[model samples]
Every structure is written in C-alpha cells, then in structure tokens.
Target: MARLTAREALSYGMFGNAAMLQNALDGKANISLASRSLPEITRQLRDAIAKRTVSAEGYPEKVGQPAISTELLPWALFEEFESLAVDHTGETVFLPPGAPQNIPRWKNVTFDAKEILELWPIANQQIDAWMNADFANNPLKKRKDRISDCTRAIPCTFATATAAFNRSPSKKRSRGQRATNRP
Candidate 1:
C-alpha cells in the first residue's frame, strides 16, 4: 500500500469516508485518532460532516451515547467561537460583539476561521480538479489521484516541524564536507 501522505492524512482526518478513517486507524498511519492533531481532526470531521461523507450511523458506538446528529454538530462546533474575551475582573465576563480578538490565538486552540477557510476550499478544489484531470476516464486512477491531490494540498505542521528538526542537525555540516561525502 502506498504510504499516506500528510495531505491525505489531513483529508482523512477532516472529511474522509468511514472506511478510510478505519483503514487509517488500522494501518497505524501517523495521523490515527490517538496521534492526530486536534486541528486536523476538527478539519476532517468538519469536512466529512459537511460533505456527508460520514453519516450519523457512522459515528463510533461508545458508552457516552452522545447524540450524533450531523445537522447539529457543525453549529455546536461553531458555538465554541462565540466569544473571544478576557475576564479581567476575576469573574466570568462575556465578550461583546465584534471584539478584536487575536486570530492567531484562536488558531492555536482549534480550527480558526482563517485556517478552516483556507483548508475547506482547497479540499473542494482538489476533489474538483482531480475529477477533471487525467484520471477522469479511469475510476481507479481517479481515486488515487484524488487522494494524492488532497493530501498534497493540505499542510501538516507536524510534518514540517519534524522535517525542520531532522534538517537542523544536518545544516551544521559545511558545504565542502557535504560535497566531499557525495558518491
């Protein structure tokens, strides 16, 4: 099986089919439920629910028996961003409408408006482009291409961080040393 790319992981984590998510979990992909970033999960769930990729019955059966209504989940998730206020009075204070909240701070917490907006459209574009591309006439190839395109477009900060970490040590080596070591 081809290794799941960071972009695919994001898409699967955001709006992947139920079978796809299960497959990802079973395969122990880097972005399994236990290991996936919350933003990625949020994006995946949001996208899936929005696109009807995951139906109410597709939600995992658990003891909590949380109501799994696709219609409500989106609004419930959106409610989290109801206010961006600081309670300076040492008491609970509600933020007024149109408060000038820091957007980056929200991004750090969950899928902020900016990040969601950036990712959602790209996901749609990837799917649409894949449908119209070279794979249009081939069902199997189209599936592969869609997955590839989706995964390629989505950004994975964890992957970027890891790459940076790996490269940091190597960056110290002089160019002459690198050149001399080449085969």
Candidate 2:
C-alpha cells in the first residue's frame, strides 16, 4: 500500500473544495486523522463520514487468524461491503462486485500497482529521515532502545529424544518364533 503525503491528505480531506476545509475548521465537518497508510486514512474518512466505530471481536487460536464480525448501521453498510471487497482483492483500489451497470464513470482514473511498489524504498528513506529530524528537534519525545541477553540454550532441539519405543523388538522375535514353530 502507498503512504499518502500530508499535502495529499489535506487535499483529499478538502476534495478540491475550499469550503470543506472551512467547514471542518468551523466544526461543521469532522476532523480528518492522519494514518500510517492510505487504506487506514480511507477507513478513517469513511468512518467519520458514516459516524461509525469499529471494535475488535476477539483473538483466535493462531497468530494470523482473521477475526470476524462487525457492527454497522444500515446506511453505513456500503462501507462494510467496500472493506470486504478490498480484503478479498488484496488491493487498495477496487470496485465492489455487482456494481450497477449504469454507475457514473470516473475520469482520468488509472490503476498502477507497479508504480506504488517502485516508490516504497524512496518513501521509507524519506520517512526515516523525517523521524530522525523530528527526534533531533524535540528532546522530550526521545525514545530509548532496549536489549536482552539469553543465558541458557537447549541441545538436540530437532533430534528425536526417544528412539527405543520405535524399535519393534516384538517384530524381531516374531520371525524367530515363527521359524521354530513351523510344521
């Protein structure tokens, strides 16, 4: 996923309309929140527009288990569908399946997955530089690094611990007993 610039975020919040910013400042519109990724921003925008909130259901047995269940109002159902569509496609931009055929077209819209991936390294470098600059400018927010040392280690972690049980002594004795009992 692509990380949106602050300028892009401001523009998106206004949607090319100066009145939107004015409304937001005047408390007539909801304030937009900054997020680490575009998808997070989009979700926040959608939630703000719908006046909705999301809560985690519960943790599952495995590490990557998909926690299900969401509560959405009738009018906010479209946002739920959009979330499901994106999750299914594994893409940031997607049109929900079974969209109406007569839906209005969007102009000058292009889908370029490759372009997003190419900018990742540059984006990471820029973000790292910005973080370092911020830290230098503000000592109060300075963070510390922690290190830990392991004192003990176990041997033969992969090798089986018990092999005697697997050696079938009864099977070996069975062959010798059969030869002696043969008529």
In order, the Cα lDDT scores of the candidates are 0.35, 0.29
How close to the true structure is residue 87 of candidate 2, measured as C-alpha lDDT? 18
The C-alpha stretches of model 1 lying farther than 4 A from their native spots are 1-13, 28-122, 132-183
Model 2 Cα shift for residue 13 (angstroms): 8.9
Worst 10 residues of 1 by lDDT: 84-93
- lDDT per residue for candidate 2 within 73-104, as digits (tens), equals 23244354554212111222234344543322
RMSD of each: 16.6, 25.5
Best by TM-score: 1
Question: How do the residues 57-76 of candidate 1 rate in per-residue lDDT, one tens digit apiece?
Answer: 11222355662531212333
In candidate 1, the residue pairs with backbone N, CA or C atoms under 3 Å apart (3 or more residues apart, or in different chains) clash, namely 7-151, 8-151, 13-44, 14-43, 14-44, 15-44, 15-48
